[model samples]
Target: MSTKDVMIWRSNRAGTHYVADTVVMEEPLEIRIRFQDSDGKWVERPLSITMRTPGDDQALAVGFMFTEGMLLKNQLDKVTIGLENTVTVHFKPDVRPELEKLQRNFYATSSCGVCGKSSLDSLGYTYETLHLAENLSPLSPELIGSLPQKLTEYQSIFDETGGIHAAGLFDWEGNLILSAEDVGRHNAVDKIAGKALMQQSLPFNQHILMLSGRACFELLHKALALNIPVVVAVGAPSSLAIETAERFGQTLIGFARDGRFNVYSGIHRVDALVLPKK
Candidate 1:
């Protein structure tokens, strides 16, 4: 149910005609958590309700929890897809989540994620510090430039609806390892992270995260949560995104199209030709 078909009137210079059109489906998904209380009682509560595309609901829930620091890799016991548009995550009995620490407003839109937060401090989460060794191999600019085309090839939902954002995981050589699409950019990235978590592939330090839209602070934060050292976006990046990348020692690239890209932070990771002094 990723897309829906409808009839619309298409206009052109010559004339107008009625035609069938496909649109990306947007729906609300209720992510709930079931955990054991200190008294050895089980509690189920609604965590968040986000608007996203219909598919990959489980991954979305897992990734969101991971990024928000509510669930760790080992804490996950199982995920059950409840009634329509609802997902319940059961954590291990020993894993008691600090629900009060979550400062989110409990509702999120498809476009922006952090907008639902209560304070700026809530934007920060505890993650492993990223350390790039001097001997680490640098990625070529050519490979970064080719990521958009590689990602586009696998974007079935985007091809059909033409209105979905995507996040793709790539190897050093620019080979797409996995990708996810949703109406919201953050949801897509969450799906990728969630799938990786399920597969026991935490800490994507050796991978590159590619985005189909402008880079934002939340996206960078999610990448940091997964320890992804490199992030490349097809569009421009916000000022906060640059500052975060600089502070975290992550490689950030934007405007990654037409076989060229601009490296904003961690230039050491890009093998760009040194310019001659004037």
Candidate 2:
């Protein structure tokens, strides 16, 4: 278990009191890509160092590569858990990744997007999957309200620690398919995406992706990578995230709580009948 029992203090009108509290453990996970370089020399490249909760490290690594456009799911031969807190992806035969693009000098923090990808040119393009049609059924307001509840129920770790982010995939009727929790919001999304991808369940355009926290650029990109059309977030959305979702024709819903949510883009995916009159 990546959780610790710690002492916490509370102050009231009388005095300070201490209680044992559960805290989600955060650690640095290094992702390495081992492949033959352009010169036919075998090299292991450290791609990213992300601060995340201790579990699902391999999923985070594979999903990172796939969403970053470094390696496709088909190109993934297998992932190997290595020594010293690292996970490495080994591609199939005759497949090589662009090693130069991954040589960055920034540490990816749990609270933010992918590190070292700071240029407009780098973030400019969407993967080809975004062009597909998201022919999903109209979502009900009641269903939308129920998603957060489902997420809360499945978050056993967060229930204990109260210090993690979660992402879940739900059908139009609001049935939870898969949910993953992590210290990083992006890592949580990546974990769910990796699970679906490994199960050959990509292009989830008919489904919805829900986030437990604010929707950011990386989370939006992860949804797009999987061809997920409707993104429901419990918090606000970044300006770039809204713009990217609008451009890709994705329904970006923010502040999704208490039976209400704000759809910033691709509102066509949502039914106006379920919305309030302006």
Candidate 3:
């Protein structure tokens, strides 16, 4: 990663300003993918490109695959991403389960799926519901109150650009466990998931996952896939995310700011004496 110099400006209370020097962060290089359905055979077709920060492209690819429901964990043979704008994910043969669902209109985009799926109902998937450990205690108000500050403390890139989204994991005791930042909020979640998967600390049912933005259906889908018992967001949640959370018995919190928050579902996880208004 090389550094580039840029001009900066600063002003004081007296409306006095100065031109200074600064180093700007580089954009992430996006690796766009395309698929070719040659007769009955599916081939990897390279289509387009974009510029990104150039790290964790593999995780981004995997996350994209999972979100699109094109490849599950057991269905993938391997995912090999190259240094350049190329990524190849090999799937096991004779697994054309949803070939029709794989429409030709599937075009990869640089933005994460805020409008991910066609219908809200399509976002809901039957997930394995995990019971929390009996020994695991509920999250206290004090712990919840300090989360935003702690998340900001760990956000290196956000402090640098204020243009990135973040996702962080914390223990029941509110200890800052792990954090990841990306231009896309979903990518941030995927990076955190990829890191936890690499460390073999998944099935984070006892832990809390927090997002820097509003809770969307895609985030809920990923949380259900990971079997995370609780998800908190700094902003409001989508109606579909709330529905999925309730259906899966996962706790959902939103509008968490300035020492107040709202719990959308599974209120049992938070140990406050008074619950939020519906």
Candidate 4:
């Protein structure tokens, strides 16, 4: 395994230098894809490579393809990871997408991506009519507030590296159902989604998704694919993520800290209970 220990310097009133030991971040690995064309020809294409935790590389690639409109569930044949930081995704021979212009860059940092929308109009262009259950109930405040501490208990990997982002799944009662941590927030969510898919427990609507980072379009897309109706994040939701949630009728909660949160869209699912005038 490739790992490193790094030191940091923090300037405070107490001191100007602080030796904080942390795991070194693995640089982004390039993900190249190859598939058979319609004319019985094999074509190799270079896809977007990202800075990831390296644990769930296959799922991360699949999720990336799914979100970027380059892949459909049934069209994929298999994903193979080779030696020395390389992944190849193969598709069925007859599978063809209308990707006329493959627009991308070399590197995708944790904070951004190449293909995802940067504007409302771009978001609308990529938005798919999500499938969701309409009559879902709201999570109680008690249930909602207890998530962070519960999440803390399941973070074994984070305990080891302190260099990962986590995504946790919880039931209506705030029980820590499942959790995963990765260097990339999206990768963690994709791992959760891919596991659910493999178990045939997908369309993850009945549970709440809590992210360690701010909500983004890719996260919303993953939730939508699983038919997840409730998504909570410890950070904020971007404008695109908010729009996606509103378009799909999924509840979007962000700034989830210290028992208080903001609902950007689909607030009805939260079931706001107002007090009577005393």
Candidate 5:
């Protein structure tokens, strides 16, 4: 369901031909929350509507709530996937969410998640600083370089549509633990985080996050929310992304491809001995 076929006219130097083409699917998914209000009545409210590819909707909802600091794993009762592109998260009866504090207008596009924010202050969500063990083994540059190829093997949707973003989680040894894809880069990361949350795996402190596109501030912010210590991207990182990583002790690497990568922060996590010789 992640890809759809449509007829189009393809033109090349040889000639123009009518053919069926595949494209990544984009659709609106409404995320809702169900909890007991102060008056002891059950209340269900729309939280956010995001444009994303049509798989992993439940994880997206859970991840969104976790990153937004609205829902904790212990408070989650169950998730219900309804028709018409809607997902509802039911919380424990005692759990009351402070919906007023969330300044988002509840709409997010595939390109940007923060576009619906009502103020700049809401952008600064509290994040924990990462602290790696002194005895932890540093990741080698060769292992980092090999991640992109490994990630591609998991991107079944991208191979058909050629238009999707992916977020992959890898261990120190460079084995992919999980990966998710969506039209929005942030949603992809959210899906991965949501999956981990459902599996009772929070604080990805021992893993590396790999991005299929440029590392933006929002993506880094989500990574921080999940306590992922290292982030690698096939593209470049934004100025704010680098600042955030440097500020929070997370390692940020960009341009990771073809047996090379550039580490922007937390250089100590990457072994210096294996760096490509000039």
Candidate 6:
């Protein structure tokens, strides 16, 4: 755990005053990969260090590994937490990570996930995702509307920092499965994804992925990694995010709050009926 209190000088219309403000603890976490060498000895490799909000370091590492396509089910024999600033992922005895393919230096920014991409052509994803439209059940307008508030209710960190991003996993009836917050939205997503993976809850197609901010391509990519179908956002969706969701036949909803939302892709998953004008 990290400290939530930080001193700051507040300047409002009333006057300037010093106050003890709460903030999300941001720190650099080193994610190391431990695998067997050619001689069958365990060798530790530093994968990537990231700035995170200090909790759920293991989940962040696992989530990043899964979403980045750097891990396989069998490869993950076990996971262990190390020092306060480190998380180590151990693979099975015979499993080896293809280090060359995992080439993103994802450490520059806390909020931006695609900081070290090699090329735009790489955007053509290599992994195949489950087509969610065939299995999707329609979500009610009221349920979709309730997700943002539900997301907010679980944001203990954001309530203090007022500067962090959050991600929540909810069932069709708007029941919260889990939620996480970080300065980086992607990190928050990774933590939740990692937790689900650790618990073997893959293929979250029946759940809704609610975002605290605008929906982006990276978030969509992360959702696709787990085969999650419906994505609801409290803010807007980018054009590319919409296109990605369309390509996967996944439901993407944005501007979702206060009993209203816009469905950009896979409208069939949402019961958006046109009401009669009075």
**Which candidate leads the pack in TM-score?**
1
Candidates, ranked, TM-score: 1, 5, 6, 2, 4, 3
Task: Quote the positional error of residue 56 for candidate 6 in Å.
Answer: 0.7
lDDT of 5 at 213: 96
Residue 253: error of model 2 in Å?
A: 0.8
lDDT of 4 by residue, 139-196 (tens): 7776776777788787766776776788988876677666777777877777676555
lDDT of 6: 0.83
lDDT of 5 at 95: 86
* Top-scoring candidate (lDDT): 1
Full-model lDDT, candidate 4? 0.72
TM-scores for the candidates: 0.94, 0.90, 0.75, 0.80, 0.93, 0.91
- Give the Å error, residue 162, model 3: 1.8
lDDT of 3 by residue, 163-245 (tens): 66788898887887888777667777776665565455666777888898999888877776666788999989989889878
Q: Candidate 5: which stretches are off by over 4 Å? A: 116-135, 274-278
TM-score of predicted model 6? 0.91
Model 1, span 1-278: residue lDDT tens: 99999999999997999999999999999999898989989989888899999998999999988987778899999899999999998999877887774435368899887665553356564334454333568988778888999999989999998999999999777888889999999999999989998889877888899999999988988888888889999999999899888877889999999998889999999888879899
Superposed on all Cα atoms, the candidates' RMSDs to the truth, in angstroms, are 1.9, 2.4, 4.4, 3.7, 2.6, 2.6
Model 3 spans > 4 angstroms off: 1-5, 8-43, 46-53, 75-78, 91-114, 127-136, 198-200, 275-278
lDDT of 2 by residue, 25-143 (tens): 99898898877766777777778888889887788888877877777878877788998679988877667776666676358888876645564356656556365465566777778
The lDDT per prediction is 0.87, 0.81, 0.67, 0.72, 0.86, 0.83
**Model 2 whole-model lDDT (C-alpha atoms):** 0.81
Q: Please, what are the lDDT tens digits per residue for candidate 5 over residues 141-168?
A: 8899999999999999999989999989
Clashes in predicted model 3: 8
Residue pairs of candidate 6 with colliding backbone atoms: none
